[model samples]
Target chain A: MPLVDSVLAQYFEDALKRADAMAPDYALLWQSLQAATYGGKRLRPALVLSAYAGLGGPDPAEAAEVAAAFELLHTALVLHDDVIDRDFKRRGVPNLAGAYRSRAAGRGVPLEEAAHRGQSAAVIAGDLALTGAYRLVAASDLPGELRLRLLEELDAAVFASAGGEQLDVEFSLPGRRPSLQEVLQMSRLKTAVYSFEAPLRAGALLAGAAGREVEAVGTAGRYIGTAYQLVDDLLGMFGDEELTGKSNVGDLAEGKCTPLIAYARLCPEWQELAGLLGGTPSAAEVRRARNLLEECGARGYVEDLVECYAARARAVLAEAALPAALLAELDGLLERAVQRSR
Target chain B: MPLVDSVLAQYFEDALKRADAMAPDYALLWQSLQAATYGGKRLRPALVLSAYAGLGGPDPAEAAEVAAAFELLHTALVLHDDVIDRDFKRRGVPNLAGAYRSRAAGRGVPLEEAAHRGQSAAVIAGDLALTGAYRLVAASDLPGELRLRLLEELDAAVFASAGGEQLDVEFSLPGRRPSLQEVLQMSRLKTAVYSFEAPLRAGALLAGAAGREVEAVGTAGRYIGTAYQLVDDLLGMFGDEELTGKSNVGDLAEGKCTPLIAYARLCPEWQELAGLLGGTPSAAEVRRARNLLEECGARGYVEDLVECYAARARAVLAEAALPAALLAELDGLLERAVQRSR
Candidate 1:
């Protein structure tokens, strides 16, 4: 993971330099990207490294490039996601779009105009990062066959994520109410595949692991990733803002149909809870909605689901036939990921 | 060009099939993308095929794939450009985002929300096309080295386009008036490099042309591409709306700081023309602005500039010593490209 971080740092530094040479205005994009990507858990890269090592990959260098590529993919998706969600901030700070919007606002541009300018910049920034991920992989020293295979993996991740995002957006439309099963599938596709399955599988492939072994690791990743996202849904509701750097009620305000929300939709108290979800709920309204979720067992149900998936992940990893060191590393990463307060 | 069109058609058909297998909701994206790309000039592909043939390349199939990749790149950029410019239509038809917007509106979604959803989908659509360009090239049967070279060319195009888009956006901000030289550079970065220079160089490279030959083609492409964009600006302001499928006054309405505007900025009547821009001007106001541009000689000045660039392109092509067939083909393409009303 440390190696991956250094690789990413160097990669972005080179990009920033090239950007500055190209045009100073473009450098702001690189700068904003650097800031947005500063302190993620690096969970994807860790998964890549752990899987690569566990599967007996020869050199860390090749795996590092793949890891960095995933990080760029993550950044690219996050940038675009911000635009989709109309978010100007992430982790309690101004995002790339927010930075541009703030600058425009300071320059006396109208608020709507400023925001549009910012989002437009973010679109181009995402484009650069997305294609830059492929550029990095194409320029890497991997064998041609392996490079193509890895690129195919990347393509699958991108396609699935796009589908999931579209579903998420559509589900939020006025009259659409998806079932709990559909919600779970969307979350798995949106978060699990790219953040977990692809990175883990890529690492194993780099290690030249057998097909069976790769599939096994991906299965484990699927469980772990689902559990991770389910926990994220919980955190969005109840986590400490100081630690999570996100408003606990913001998801409710946005009317995001998380698994808990889906569970609530199936419950008797849903009529009252729905009233508090889609608008700017007062603090009292938020508290009452939280209590209703608890009273209706939606909160408990989602928590139990997370633990269930986590247990399944552990069971799969135990039987995966990975090396002892890697297995222990995976266990630690999984525990920290799903059990975290933030 | 025909081969490239067929290649693109088949590519989209296969992609649509895959999307259907993935999820029914995802199919609309592919459908919209296919429609958006259905009937372009296919200029980029022509350059690639021409260079490949003129340079004695053994296969048109390989060049077709490369040409199709460029078309995808063009579509991808146009998709994002629509989002940036807040345009729902292109060439008088609804774009990908517009298609999505229309669907949402038909479903009774609020206008603003529908527009947002449409733009978000366009962002994702652009992402797919941009990466799909690289994927197509990577999956081609060309030698790995050449494949890598082509991918690098694509990277260069994307980067330059992003920079150019940022500059264009920034230049449009209130109080920023750039010189004609700066406007030319922006237009070149936004259009010429990707549309002309890269494709020409790529074709020559695909044919195993010498380094000097590749560079020469790129040089000729730069001149021709600049001329083409200059002609496009003229069409935007003066061409028949029926023939061009765009409003002649739309550029003025948006206050796009084109080369013609830069020329007007240097003239005394600039103030009068400026007043008619950046807003929804009435027909009479638009007519007055056009007359002012003509009366101040900005229109004539831009026309002369176009001819100058066209002549430079001809001179460069003549001295490049390309094969007779390719030379003649390029000449024909250049004339049609620059002199067309549409």
Candidate 2:
């Protein structure tokens, strides 16, 4: 585990202790939250730490704190996103929300009531994580000025993410099909900025990097994040469940409007079948839909777009003044983002 | 309106303009949030301003920003609370969450789907507000140290409130009724501190009030807030709709284990009727419930608790070194908290 991960581990241990000491009501919630922080790429926080070190900043401690903050923010957003989407699984396992829902059922709460309790717990759990993210930064030993600026960055991400979330939800409504352009924009706003731009820029800001350097990192993150989303869109449809750790057919069943689906809608070969996207198709129907998507060249189109973003990321690296170590790391990230099977 | 209220009004006007410029997806949400801010007594924000002035803070601009922040926090929590409680109305009107739900229904969306969308919108809307509240303070003109310390205060409130919210949900579960001691702690954590302690301390901190003065304001806020919740419990059961602007039977129908109900559970006169507290009683049953409550003297017990809190607030006022102007404003606030028919 990295520095930020260790810090996060210690943070949760102490936090859960305090919360439990305060009231036993939140014990399960705290435990679920702990489980949530256990795995993942830790990508966002890594970006924070990398950016801070890359920019020649003196405070690894502050960078670690900020990194943990990003992770918490991501956790809260993902938790809430699952609730809105009614998803019960993440990374091939029951997520924090799912765990609560399952617990309620295991305890013999009726289905609807159990679901309600699960959602309630998840909502409150997410609320705790969201505030905890801000609390991490607020309690950091960093000078007040540094912490304030970082908070401003954090807030900007939250604001932009809200707009993105609104767009995502609005576009996903039944019988509401958004344009390809809108999907791309929403993708950038909803995922790319927060995942890529926020962590990278936050790191740079902590390092006291120049405005231009921070802007360059943002551009790099945008391209990289967009590429990553494109790949995710691919994996959701074509990847194996064993590798992706997801049902893979969920995007189709949930009627998620992804770049692949949006582009497929524009293709004459797939346009006729596009209406079946969210009809909760059977397993056989999903396979047929997947085959059609691939045969119609929609997958190719998305792959090409992913390449475009990857190339743009390279272009940014060529021009940015970031450290060599940072550039090498970003290159590796880009490779993983665009080429990962999962 | 007071200076803080006007400032809040202007702030929203500008914020709405900016949000509209960014995206139309949030237009309805922003409008409803603006509506929610209107027509209230502006109690929490008023406390912020009062505490700031009482602490001899010269910058009304900073005070106004903090006041608006408190109002935003309150609005967000209330919106989410309604979702958790499944209430659709607030202040005799369709609140932000209710507005979305109603609009969806009006558009002929199916009942279940529309309700889902409404809840989804409310969740996101509240998230936006919560993040927006932090943004306000982060973007304030206060010095870094002051803002940092203020954020510590803010984070503490959010942390405590989250625990309080969890306690509230757990206690309200179908078969579990909280003890009177737990109820009082919940009331203090959920209402008193955030509504009273937080804003008051925030303002005092911004004004650079001495530690003792800040502590004094916290004590004053606690007593006042406790009294306010007690009155709220009373009004929920006994107050009229025309004055209280709510379906007073809701507290009983929802089986809210308020202090009154807790105490009444021990009273022999109400033991048989106590089981009906959360049974979604009919209009006549509600009437009978009310009369029984009064007859058993449960109302008097709650009234006595309210009086005790009021006296404590008065005692804090007598000892606190707050300015005379602030003391007068607090006196008026205390009167409203305990004496208002609503």
Candidate 3:
């Protein structure tokens, strides 16, 4: 973990230096990106490093670069995700986009113009982070064949995520009606492969693990990652803002059709709550909608779904015949992943 | 050329097939991407192949893959560029984002929501193309070391372009008053490196050309690529829409401060034309602004600048002692690239 942190830090330092030579404005982007890299759970990097060390990878240093790559990839995706969702804040403060927007506003730009500038900055920032991630792997000291293999895996992860993201946008449109099954699939593809499956498998591959073991870890990852997203949905709706660093009403305002919403759609209270979401709902409206969802068992239903996937992940790990250390570590991670309030 | 075309076609065919399995809506995204790939002059790929073959690369097949990779990268950047600029059309037709917007409109979604969906789709589609470009190089039949080197170069190109894009966005903000020198720097960073230098150097590298030769071609590329963008600016203002596949008044509408605008700032007529830009100027206003720019010598100034850069490019190419065939091909490209009315 420390190795990955150092790699990421060094990477940003070099990037910042290069950007400084370009222009002050460009340098600001790198500075903002460095800030965005902080405060993350490092879940993906943890999976990469843990899998590698637990499976007897010879060099933590090599795996560190790969782990750091995953962290960069995560940052890239989150930046773009915010742009798509039109979110300007993360972790209870101004994100890269919001910061740029505020910068513009401070300079007397109109609010709308400032907002557009912020979003455009975000798009460029994300491109940097995304390509930077690949550069890390491509430029690392790893063996050529091994690096190529890892890149292929990374590509598949990104490809699936892009598809998943498009599907998410499609599902969010008013004219489309996505079933709960489709929602779950979107969640898996959008969150699971890159966050968990690819990192886990890459670590295993780097450790010279057998194909069967790599496949097993990837399968386990799919379940655990889906459960993690499900928990995130719960936190988005019910968790305290102080703990979650997100407004509980934000998802309701966006009318995000999470598993909770999907379940609520079939409930008797749907008519009452349906109009409150996917709009600029007030605090009172959000509260009423939450209450209706709870009364209709939607909240309970999503929680049950999380537990089900977590259990399945546990089952896969147990039967995968992984090293004792890795199995225990994964078990601990799974519990914390799904149980976290944020 | 046919080889590159086939590679791209196969790439899209496979991509579309995969998207089809995801969902109908997702598949539509791939369809849009395929359409977006059409009608390009394939300048980047041409540079790659020309450099490779002209330098005596053994296998055109392998270089074709790398060339195709450049095309994908171009498409990726274009998609993101449209999102940043909030443009829905490309080549005089609905682009990936516009197509999605139209789809939503057909389904009775509000115009605003549909536009948002379309933009989000472009973001996702760009991600796919960006990563897919890397995949092409990583998964190519080229030797591992060669592939890794190409990826590193590609990474540098993307990084520079990202920085350039941010700078462009920054300069467009009301508070920024960039000089002509600064504008030229942005143009070179945003357009020259990825579009010209990288491809030429990459092709030479693939062909195992000497470092000095690669460096020479890269220098040539910087000049030519910058000149190409200058021509694009001229087309954005003076060229007919039917010929250019873009609105002639778009640059004025966006208030983009190109080198011409930078020069115009010092002219007597600037005050008369300034307010007409960076706002939604009416057609008459656009005409008046155009007249003012021409009267102020900004248009002729940019044209002279293009000739200056193109001449420098020709000098470098002539002195580089490149193979006769590649040199002739590059000269022909430079002429068409800078002189095209479109």
Please, what is the whole-model Cα lDDT of each candidate in the order they appear? Answer: 0.86, 0.80, 0.87
Here the TM-score of candidate 2's chain B is 0.92
- lDDT (Cα, tens digit) per residue for candidate 3, span A133-159: 877777777777788889877877787
Chain B structural similarity as TM-score, candidate 3: 0.95
Looking at model 3, residue B172 earns an lDDT score of 76
The interface RMSD values of the models, given in order, are 1.2, 2.2, 1.5
For each candidate, give its TM-score against the true structure: 0.97, 0.93, 0.96
Ranked by DockQ, the better of candidates 1 and 3 is 1
Query: CAPRI band of model 3?
Result: medium
Residue B46, model 3: Cα distance from true site in angstroms = 1.1
Q: How accurate is candidate 1 locally (lDDT)?
A: 0.86
TM-score of the B chain in each candidate versus the native B chain: 0.96, 0.92, 0.95
For model 3, give the interface RMSD: 1.5
Q: Retained native contacts per candidate, as fractions?
A: 0.62, 0.42, 0.70
Error of 3 at A136 (Å): 1.8
TM-score, chain A, per candidate? Answer: 0.96, 0.94, 0.96
- Predicted candidate 2 versus true structure: per-residue lDDT over B159-189, tens digit per residue: 6777778788777665676888888888888
Per-structure clash totals for the candidates:
0, 0, 0
